[model samples]
Target chain A: MTAPFKGYLRADGRKGIRNVVAVAYLVECAHHVARQIVQKSDDMDVHLIGFPGCYPNDYAFKVMSAVTTHPNVGGVLLISLGCESFNRERLKSAIEASGRPCEVLVIQNSGGTLSTIQKGREAVERLKAIAAETPVVDMDVSELVIGTICGGSDGTSGITANPAVGRAFDWFGAQGAACVFEETGELVGCETIMASRAITPELGAALEACVQKAEAYYTVMGYGSFAPGNAEGGLTTQEEKSMGAYSKSGAAPICGILQPGDIPPTGGLYLLDVVPDGEPRFGFPNISDNAEIVELIACGSHVTLFTTGRGSVVGSAISPVIKVCANPDTYRKLSEDMDIDAGKIMEGRATLDAVGQEIIDSVLATAAGQRTKSEAMGHQEFILTYKAFDPLGPACLPLKRA
Target chain B: MPEALILLHPTDNVLVCRETIAPGTVATIDGEAVTITQPIEVGHKVARVDLRPGDKILKYGAPIGSMTKDTPRGGHVHMHNMQSDYIPSHTRNASGGAA
Candidate 1:
């Protein structure tokens, strides 16, 4: 009930734990220049992220717009290759309208990569200066938006880290915080169980249908969206992995279902349906863990709880990722990358509730500016790819419709 | 069971090994000791009870897959014996998953 964290209040009224200056490239051609700008800035708070397509997509625009104005982002510097189909002006105007300091540098107009990088570095300095003066506001637990994703999962993920995250989610629910768990591809087998936990029957049906869509999509792609490390790590089936992945939801009632770029309107548990609506224009719903993290970030998650049994060490650009090791063996191998030792639950040395509290405490500490292991290790990875959507059905956006 | 073996749910038909179990390691399950038939790696599953082929494999109290071959108590349960009823799973080099 107490506001224990102080957040940078954006001009648009959203609060952010990290005021990052994002240098986004409009297409793959400008990626080098954008990366150079951020790398040369020597500022940990500045990051590079971009889409690779030259084709303009409404879905891309929507996600990019939402991400650029995300609460974690204070300012944006868009780098365009000048000839790509991506609408830089539209993206720039959206950021400006959000009252964030944003500008676009067309590489061709700037003469070349060197010129753009130099201009981009100066832009980062100005953005950082603007970000520094942003007002700090006290935020309550109720105002926090937390997300969970499981990557490189194995057998222990379900029994330990995933369930522990679920327990932390239960605490977040008790504190009235908005929490999100995602990857419909990973939630395939647990749809019925997941739907039963929905706040309403309509929402339950909507949740089932989303998983159905993901199953069909992945089936067409010739793979179950699982990785080889998963098997080596002792995961036998995709649905089995889904059951383990489902544990991160804890036992909270599902309040709503969302697509990327759609922020939760009220505090409760929600499901983020990352699969594209129409035909699978994108090869995979999520290319990797960071892709899914980006969608969660697009939904305005302040921090992400990442469970990895095969030892993935990725942090997001816009939000800090708290890595929870699910296997005691993997934990020993990559202790430096992990924030919480949920693996102890598997070893019987620690109870689930204890590790769950550790996760919640990590969230509070990260919000209070104590960098997570990933953040302190400077793992600012990001990726945004193209996809299409046919708008949400009647039941998906309950809060927005209500 | 060795402290390393955990039953996620009362209804689960498999036990998750918290650490690798060498052959001949005896685990006390439900107060009964069962000797490991084969080496089971950490994070792998072991049959909690006898199961026939086509029987549903339950973990986390949910059906993860189905047994492709009969499995005995204390036997290692993985892709060799069980497979997902949903979309077929793949490793890095193989593509012959059941569709």
Candidate 2:
């Protein structure tokens, strides 16, 4: 079956569902100015994203570089405070290297907030013009890189939405689209089972080690990824929530492991390890839901499927998030904010396969440019912070191309 | 009639409430009549069998946590009686709103 959609063609030969002009603030100091520019521009296609750190961080720089060059991004307008440790010149070069239009504004050099806002607005107009010139091309499902994440999970998550998304992932993986499921922090109890699904024994071993690392890291932090909201929603333990979140990966054979900026080399199932490597010095691995969404976008996911039992209304800057509500009650409360209601599976009014097909159909429709509930409501949430990681070992990416 | 409780897996000793079950509600469990001893909200778990303090709480046929106290059949299985073997779960009240 050929699933076809019209997409903005990038110079790197990747297809983008959205042609967005990103107005990025390199430091927290420039955030106000950059935000003003996006707000004044008043265009849904213009988005705001940034790193708030004034200190130098390799992880921040790498994620910034990955997001700016993401296929969904058409052009970029970078705002710098001029005194921050972030490498603006290198980031601009990386964006330009991908053949996308990029410009940087220094708030200090451009005469502070008001003047920079004016100039940034003008730059956004120019970038939008260049972005609009991107040719529209017919794209197929095989070229899509889709990511799945479960947030605000509960007992019903595993029973409904999460497994339904798993079925969707299975379908997408079977169709040869790159399917990524994430955060070893949430995979604590399922590591052994997940490893058994890996294509090679070496990759399987690497998968197990990644989860062990997450468990150790969280143990040091005095907290697991399990949150208060989870307990309130009937999830009693970290492992229970982990099992619920684990269903989002579906049943596909694990292909490889990916660090934040590592794009999948082939069309298959990949596990995105969001936990920082080495000692846990940087607090929680992901501060919030949006951070994980950003990591998924950094992995070059064209779209993300977010399954929620407690309900989360978040859409990323570069990609669309399809919210699949697991609880019928939450779906009733946030009906306007939800995309698919997998809660019906519990009522027996609909089957899991039916909801899974509905999710896939919603993805194809979203890929073809139908706005998700969050997107239509103008939810362009983005966040980035400090973290560190050593390069992935050879065993992690057995299928990686040089 | 809507199913009051569902066993996710054949081996699971905990049954999940398909809908809210109020106190004194009569529900049939495995051909045996049992009365709901406490309020069980939708998506919450109930003991499928008599559970002891050291017994593991099984859901989806996997051990999720351990029981901290004895719970009779159809009793609510939640944070009050079960605790994680990996890490302690926090609540808004338990962590002083830090959660």
Number of the top TM-score candidate = 2
Chain A TM-score, candidate 2? 0.99
Q: What TM-score do all the candidates reach, one by one? A: 0.97, 0.98
**Chain A: TM-score in each model:** 0.98, 0.99
Among these predictions, the greatest lDDT belongs to 2
| lDDT per residue (tens digit) for residues A250-345 in model 1 | 998899998899989888899998888878767988888898998899999999999999899999898999999999989999999999988887
lDDT of 2 by residue, A121-182 (tens): 99999999999999999998988899999988987999999999999999999988999999
Per-model RMSD to reference: 2.0, 1.3
Per-residue lDDT of candidate 2, residues B40-83 (tens digit) = 88788899999999898888777898999999988989999999
At residue A277, candidate 2 shows an lDDT of 92
Clashing pairs in 1: B1-B28
Candidate 1, residue A149: CA error in Å? Answer: 0.5
lDDT of model 2 at residue B83?
93
Candidate 2 lDDT score relative to the true structure:
0.92
